[model samples]
Target: MSGTGFWTPVFDIEKRGDGSILMRQNDPLTDHRPTLADALDHWAETAPDRPFLARRAPGGGDWRRISYGAARAAARAMGASLLTLGLGPDRPLLILSENSLEHALLGLACTCVGIPFAPVSPAYSLVSKDHRKLREIARTLRPGAVNADDPEAFAPALAALAARGRHVISNEDGPGRIGLETLRGGDPAGAEEARAGVGPETIVKYLFTSGSTGAPKAVINTHSMICANQAMVRDCYRFVAERPPVVLDWAPWNHTAGGNKVFYLVMTNGGTFYIDDGRPVSGRFDETLRNLREIACTWYFNVPLGYDLLVEALEGEPALAEMFFRDLGMMFYAGAGMSQITWDRLRAVARRTAGREVLLATGLGATETAPFALACTEVQERAGNVGVPARGLTLKLVPQGGKLEARLKGPTITPGYKGDPAKTAEAFDEEGFYKLGDALRPADPEDFTKGFFFDGRMAENFKLTSGTWVPVGAVRAALVDAMGGLVRDAVIVGENAPELGALLILSEAGAAMAPEAREAALAERLAAAARAATGSASRVRRALVLTEPPSFERGEVTEKGSLNQRQMRGNNAEAIMTLYDGGPGVLTF
Candidate 1:
């Protein structure tokens, strides 16, 4: 096949009974279970009537249900349709869609038929006007089929590839585009009957990183990698080892947390996954709240923003409090650093509802590692320390300056970046371990039993005018913890400037506190707290309360919910300039 294409695994996937597909290979990791296809197939056999895909619509209503049996049928049908197109293991199909029940089914279809599918971010399509990232994605995937579910935006790009041997599938009705309705209606029975053999190492999907450095790189995820990461995280947390887990989350499928961790965790255990259609914006969160009332999740996960909003809803509603507590396994928060004030409320609610506080743990993972690298199982009164490496994973601390950088070696880890050899080289060490780029020495050099505290990224720290290095993550976490929940998050300013200062976002509830009442108010209390916590060169002198939330589409926040420091300064140039000009103690305008 040409000189040498990308690395394709020698192993393959085979369809098991019901909806699952079993892997037919042996490896260093856990004895191979079902392929992604096998995992979903198992759900169909064991729990056919269970609601596998529970989704809330755009408007507020009860959950629209898709059972395990139906999901398996859809995947088989979609897989068959994929085969009828003549695409195989060699050539891949790329899905350009957002997180939806349909997206999940489409992905399963790829797994069933051995076609690699990728769910791209809406930013690279509908939200992104220029399509700069979308253009690069096309160059990277060179897909045989461009699934343009959003043709109002993707039609032009699909048209550009019209002669280049790329097929275009549209949303409803677009000229020269095969509508998804039509594709769905077309006899999936043919494709199901056509299915003969599939593989475990068969690449089921590709997800591109936001790629702040340059062009985003495509992460190649095989069925084995996803299954391994899913199994590892599940075993550590023991979220639902007894029975299948019932989860409610809305994190995008384009990222590892949503795509591999949440999706696979639900599928592997034969759990019911309810996609929270609510976004953290106006009018969207209601749908998420409705789902919470309808079905209590044994496992719950959300970014800090989603949790912050949900806590408010839970506090006000008695029914929600009862639903949240009863049969809830554990509540987990990730995607960004969490604040203590928000952390406290979660526990308070847990205690009131369950008569005992449930564990509110934070973990770490990236799109490259298939998402679950480090996580916390037990409930902690404090924040910031994510537990040790997952089972079957090895960690190393390479000394870099005053800190030791974290790197990992594991079967769950991706082989390398797809289609980019230069990135592949830089991502790994001489021994071929993936360099995590997080500069945090293990708390115990002798034993990782104590676990690792995130020191900061090796590259994130910067020097002041006094030539002192400021560890941003250490300072950021400490400052937030110090202010309690009043000051939610702060962006450490002053790289070669006079002093360290912050541009802070206030808690939604905290921000509502009366500023005139200085003693008990959030702003005044936080200022006092921030003043007391400052070290010699690291203290935040003046904090300008953030009037606006960071925008994802505006590039102020990364896909992982981390603030893009470089982009922040550029986008808020006026705000940064005001800090130097000395307008007010807090900049609201």
Candidate 2:
């Protein structure tokens, strides 16, 4: 446990000696309830007064908390109202805003009545210029109702999808919109009967994929998948169930980690969740800092970008660091691999502030696996170690191409994508394992107990003009880390080209520097990084700074902020051409 009162590492691996390997935790899984509503019911009865969910007031005024009992009462009323609207399995509810108190309650209301709900990325409805993806999603889901926090904000999207024969719900009613208060004022006569009907197989929600490649597919999330996943998380963490968890989260609920994993993690454990308005992006992280100063989280989670910004904040302010570690149990990162430098900085800050090292860890999973399949409970120094599979899950490493492809099979695994049976069939192998399209490499060949590292996404790798394959994940990580704080994230270019290139999104630190200084610093770092590389595949010879952030509407980035390399390259064809054509801003090795 690294003397930090976090998890203790205990991993085991069984090699079949054929071409496959299996890895899992040594501990058994805890008994899980059939549905998420059951967990809510249990906690509502036991810890009625505990704060279950909270969000900042409008304009970030103050925090508003909802007790478990209050939440259940509101959800029952809302669920009954939804039933009156003719919403069922076929006509699901769709939420189009960021996380909020109403969002949580309404999501629970749908699940309580065995009515499915889908939360799509807010960017699709709000940020997209043409509303292309939003229209496509509306056509695909055919939602019976749509909820948004602010009607004025999503007015365009709501009007565009109005012809789908659905009700538009808003906290504040506008023209042709239903008010939230109306739903809360409904009778709870059918709530108990509806709750009783929910079981493990009941479809609770649909979590859409990031759609980094093509059109996003809705991943079916059942009651069993969420409950079993929470069980795996509870068994792995071991300390979460002991006390009420307090989390300050900024990740959007449209994705799995924030939606099912973190939200349910807090709900199942009788925890208090503070929805952070501050994202990890520039000019918004200050909101996160404000929240952290007030709330001492028991468990913390952030992306590598958030941690990079936070490490600096923690280092500069001792009082803030003290407040942060006051009740922190463990620090976790996800959505992408964290750098070893960032990992070291985090541990050092923990040791400095708390007088002992805190457990810094990460895990591996996908939207299809309920997103909590594999976890690293141990304390390690290296980055990208995703540890072993969870207690109730199976990890199969089948040799494919030159890497071991990861496959999963468990109660938490999704049955199939919504409305896509053929695509679902192609997602799994003959043995009924969900083929995760990701590759893994053993950290220690002889001792699998050391865990495994994420090799690269099989679908993301590409061949150079020399016929040599490039592992984009590893190369991107190395390049991003090597550029120091200059690059936030990068999309590897030069697929089928002579040498590798990069389209870099500058970090806040990089953007803050003087123009000339920024370019010089970036160019020097790129040259040094390229000079240190041993092969053409690893070395980046040309680079271009991406001035615009990745467009969610264009599918250049996922809602979780992961880059889609192919999409980025294809979308920025002109930039790549300019780089090779000796453009003015191009940096060369």
Candidate 3:
């Protein structure tokens, strides 16, 4: 309602009088193509010279670009080669690499020919000391071909696999490796045949879940699910088609946020994507800052930690801030909830720089929902407002254990998890609605149209020894905001204990302070926050600063930079005990 002409907010909400609400977009869903490859072909013919993707050369040389026509031609050649390699649904392509122009092109090539591909997180292969998870994933996928950017980087992982007959491809040739140029050197004879076989039900890719509770399961992504989700996105944010979206992103393609949402959002709209080399972490964020100074993104997205760092940079650098918001229409945060403090600072910085307010929004979705189910387009200053259900999606809120559990049934929802029929059977309800396991409450209790605030994950919320249920998501966001810039994230502990506790990940500001000063400052902030608390659940009694970062291999932190609350608590049981044991370095309220 308070935004510019780029987008007009619209939603319809109906109350059933039984504490349940029905919400949908006012705009009707547009008829999208059956597959993503069709959209690429359309753009290639209509705007052959428009830039589709761009990335800096290795070691930060010149910017490399691939136009729509060039990308289409390369994809066709790659698809033809894959067909000859006998890669299809049963024997698919497995990609293990970071985000690159080649990664994007190869991913598109797989889709063009209906060749199912799974871009597994490079962490499983590159970071872990033992490639157990990667082996399990490759075994489950039974891939006919494996691809990586650098064969030397993934040499150990590649060696662990049973690679007698599998085709190995990389940018540069190595032992038993076929170069990328050679792979795509084949003619486009089989390209048309592959594209003609694709339909709405054709399998496009396999997106793996975080596996916070267990082994990661591959969620089947169909062409219909992805295409329909983009239609809903276009209906919600109308400015995308008006001008080609320019996006700078670093989120890994293994996750749906970057791989499906941002990647396809650009492709489906005939937009340009710049692969961001900088991440939101402390050491890597400088690349993001440098990119923001050069490219004025039409739409921007980052996790909460990234936003916090950007806010600090924007407060100091006026030139960078101006370039960042020059043509920006909306700023979005996901992979986790954004704190109110970060949200306020971002809006203030944008207003100061752009001389007009920009929409700061967040949405609710999961890997199973093609990663887009609800989006908030309303103008609000606070965080935690995940907007109404997307167009063409049916959202059913059921009351469970004193919370509203969200479920989805639509074309965008995944059919089920791959290679896990038992888990799939347990995933849906009797009505065939996929249980999302997240809880939500109405943003405005009296007005159902206002949207909903994320409560907490059903499995993450725990009961104290006093029989009080603690909403981890709400409490963690409140505590982090209350602590100001001291804490980046937290894991709320005290399951079956008397009171709540937290393991805090220090922010950049907090980490910059001297050891003694940091401890004293944290104590002061903890006391202030505890004084302002109103309930036992909101009141964090004891806190411990995490000395070590969460490990990706341990499942404590997901590749998307989201903390796995349950996994974190379970992995650090000794730390929790030490805090409760009245140990040193533990601040008590």
lDDT for 366 (candidate 1): 75
Worst 10 residues of 3 by lDDT: 1-10
Candidates' C-alpha lDDT:
0.71, 0.87, 0.87
Q: Model 1 off-target regions past 4 Å?
A: 1-29, 57-62, 153-163, 171-174, 185-197, 441-447, 483-488, 506-530, 545-549, 570-574, 581-589
| lDDT for each residue of candidate 3 in 324-353, tens digit (9 for 90 to 100) | 999998998898888888788889998888
Off by over 4 Å in 2: 1-18, 25-28
Which of candidates 1 and 3 is the stronger one according to TM-score? 3
lDDT score at residue 365, model 3, on the 0-100 scale: 95
Give one digit per residue, the lDDT tens place, for model 1 in 314-427: 889978989987988677777667777778888898899888767777777777788888765545666666766676666666656666677777777787777998898899
Question: What TM-score, over all chains together, does every model reach?
Answer: 0.86, 0.96, 0.97
Instruction: Please report the candidate that would top lDDT against the real structure.
Output: 3
Leading candidate by TM-score = 3
Question: Candidate 2, clashing residue pairs?
Answer: none
The regions of model 3 sitting more than 4 angstroms off are: 5-21, 26-28
Counted clashes in each candidate structure? 12, 0, 0
Sorting all predicted structures by TM-score, with the top scorer first, yields 3, 2, 1
Pick out the ten consecutive residues of candidate 2 with the lowest summed lDDT. 1-10
